[model samples]
Target: MSNLSQLLKESWVLVEERHDDVAAHFYARMFLTDPGLRQLFPVHLDTQRRCLVEALVTAAASIDDPERFTEYVQGLGRAHRKFHVQPSQFAAFHGALLEALRTVGGDRWTIEYDQAWADALGLLTSNMITGLEQDADPAFWHAEVLAHERRGADIAVLTCQPLQHPLRYQAGQYVSVEVPRYQPRLWRTYSIANAPRPDDTVEFHVRAVGAGWVSSALVRRVRPGDLLRIAAPMGTMVLDRESPRDIVCLAGGVGFAPIKALVDELTRFNRSRWVHVYLGARHRDELYDLDELLRLAATYPWLNVVPCCTDDPSWTGEHGEVSEVLARYGPWHEHDFFVSGSAPMVRASLRTLAELEIPADRIRYDSFGDI
Candidate 1:
């Protein structure tokens, strides 16, 4: 237990130290050992590894108690019910995870450390198992894409049809994309851009993050015939199933990707529920998918779409920052909200949420870690 404590603390610090490195290598190691899991991702494994690792590190940093953490970990077991994460796959991931610890930890990872990690891994996986069994399969799941528009240098609105089979996902849940780009091994996160029912191939709202390793690689290098790998679906940041209060959603730039999925799900499931979304962009030129959103708002009687622009020059649309738009729409109480976009955007929105006096139980979001 002492050794386990030491390892847990050290692992936390290590995660803080080289988060991206640890995350990137963690997935690479997993893929190297279990190439069979390769089909479960859409973006490059390297990229996916980093994002997942970072999220893990973030969760670890936020957790305050072993008992609570254990419970929290156990909660994931229920959350993952919709994802269909198999016990066997969880076991395999743990095996690969240990291999990664040894590989990444290198000189410092002794046999004793291995033993400690094995215990920790057992605890973590056990919780996952519990969480995954409760939630029923979502009504929809599948993949399809059709090109919509090519912007500036090279980006396309890959319009997708509904994935008719499988199960549907809540908005905040992001699907793991593992695809063969940048040497046939990449995995990354892409939020379901739009909401679709079961039996719908969800859309991902994406743009070139410019110097990005994966997106840039995809935009510049990858071609039409390539297959994009995606995990069945997983994540903690979905809508609250227990409540039906007024809901507020926040999104920044491309962060809108995941929240959009939630929005659509809300519309379909709680057709009468009041849900609002805030999507942000720097300026008009940087704007994307506005018409579609307006159309959605028009179609959905209970949903409202608020577009916030940093520079709404003509001021035709909502002006000022995203929070201002949030404030204007809300003197809201007991609302469930989701926010997407950059780190700054998340921070700003949190401040907005607090200022609005919204309850702690209502807000939901996924941060891209740009903060």
Candidate 2:
């Protein structure tokens, strides 16, 4: 790591545990500095605060990897466009961030640390500005919902068509979605559940979390014909077509979205590579898309689908955490792995991959934090 990256990471350790306080301070200072800026965020700042802190931590940790850092920050910058961020507002944000850091750092704060962070933020903001200005795509697209189906009480499958332009995206990428009718300014991210289709429609699988503003609105309230806003897609979990290795995909609950998309894409040309998909949920009822996946498996001899249930004793298939069951099936050290689901599930699966001595480069997942 560069001296600046080292310093930033070291300083971050001091405040990482108290990130909630840091977020509160940062936003308080920013809004206090420019009261009108408060209008730019959602009314409930709980999830937003966590997202801000996670973004900062991710950016700080990535500084040592130039390629990763550039791609992430540029995407972040472009993503921020949906918020209608103004260039003039960056100065206030910068000041507020530094103040939050200094306050949380307490006695450990030093001139060298401050200078390192200043330099880092300068680089970060400059690239973000570059990303914001160079992008020609619109900040967001308007899509009309074409279909909506509830698989269970909380899970919903929805499809939509972009009204003005093609919603071009890779098979495994995700996009932020906004329900203008129910939660206008509050946007949530969801993986596009299918490969790019000929008709320019996209699919999303959403499960409502308790009191989750956007998700509950999507599952319980959204219907066919509703107009929604779709932001530019951003993620790096897409297939590496040139890699000749076999693949392993682990999906838990609705995390199946991107995994399904990848499998859908693979079906078009894959004839040699063996693809294994492990779909896990708490109960048999929650294995919402198993029948469809099984049909795909039957149609494609190279594809294999395994359904796992953690809590269902009556489940006839695998019975354990998906990651644990995955451990029994491999010979996977040579395979490329794609993992998705709740944070705990992803973490456990990653741990399993690590224990199996999987190379870091051979595994990919979206760790951008809760949608």
Candidate 3:
């Protein structure tokens, strides 16, 4: 790792526990410095605050891996186009971030830490700008909702077709969607639940939680024929087809979206590799996509599907958290692991994988905390 990377990670730890406060401070300084920037964000700053802190942490964690870091920030830059972020605004953001860091660090702050962060931010901004400039694609795609089905009171599955150019994306990637009809200017990310199709259509699984503005609109209010805006796809959790190792996929609740897409893609040419999918939910009613996954498993000889329920005693299949069920089946040292789920579930599964002695490189994951 580079000296700046170590410094960046160490400096971040000082303010990590106070992430919410840090986000609040950063935004306050940013809007104070450039009041016009305030209009770019939502009226409710709760989700935006969490997103800011998550972005900072993700950037810091990936800094030591130049390729991964560049890919991440560049994708972030491209995705930010949906917000109409201008290149000039980056300076104000950087200045506010530095100020926020210094204020949060207090007496522990030093010149070396400031310099390292400045350098890190410089790299982040420059790569993001490059991604922005190199992108010839539209900032957002106009998609028409073709179908919507309520899986339960809180969950829904929807499909949409991009009206103009094809929406090309890898199976496990997700796109930021905006339902302007109901929640204007509020966007949330949803994984494309199916592999790319010739008809330029995509699927999403949504579960409305708490007072999520976008998720509620998507699950309950939005209907077929309504128009939605979709930003460019972003995520690095796609399949590694070249790896000779067998695969184990873990999905919790609606995190099945990406896992289903991956399994779909694998079905195309997977002849030799064994693929096991462990789908988990609190109750059997929550495993909305279990039937479809079972049908797929029955059709493919190499595919195996295990449905796990934590809260349902009537369930005849596996009983336990997905991670716990996975633990019983492991000796997974040689298999590649893909995990997608709620933050807590993902964290638990990762901890289990670490305990099982799985190499870090053999595992890839996507965790949905809020959206």
Query: Which has the greatest lDDT?
Result: 3
Q: TM-score for model 2?
A: 0.97
Model 1, range 196-260, lDDT digits (tens) per residue?
54445556655666556556654555454444545445556776666767777777877877766
Q: Cα RMSD to native, each candidate?
A: 6.1, 1.2, 1.1
- Positional deviation of 85 in candidate 2, in angstroms? 0.8
Q: TM-score per candidate, in order? A: 0.67, 0.97, 0.98
Compute the lDDT for candidate 3: 0.91
What digit string (tens of lDDT, one per residue) describes model 3 on residues 280-358?
9999999999999999989998999989999998999999999999999968888999999899999999999988999
Q: How close is candidate 1 to the true structure, as a TM-score?
A: 0.67
Q: Model 3: runs farther than 4 Å from truth? A: none
Error of 2 at 256 (Å): 0.3
Residue 120 lDDT in model 1? 74
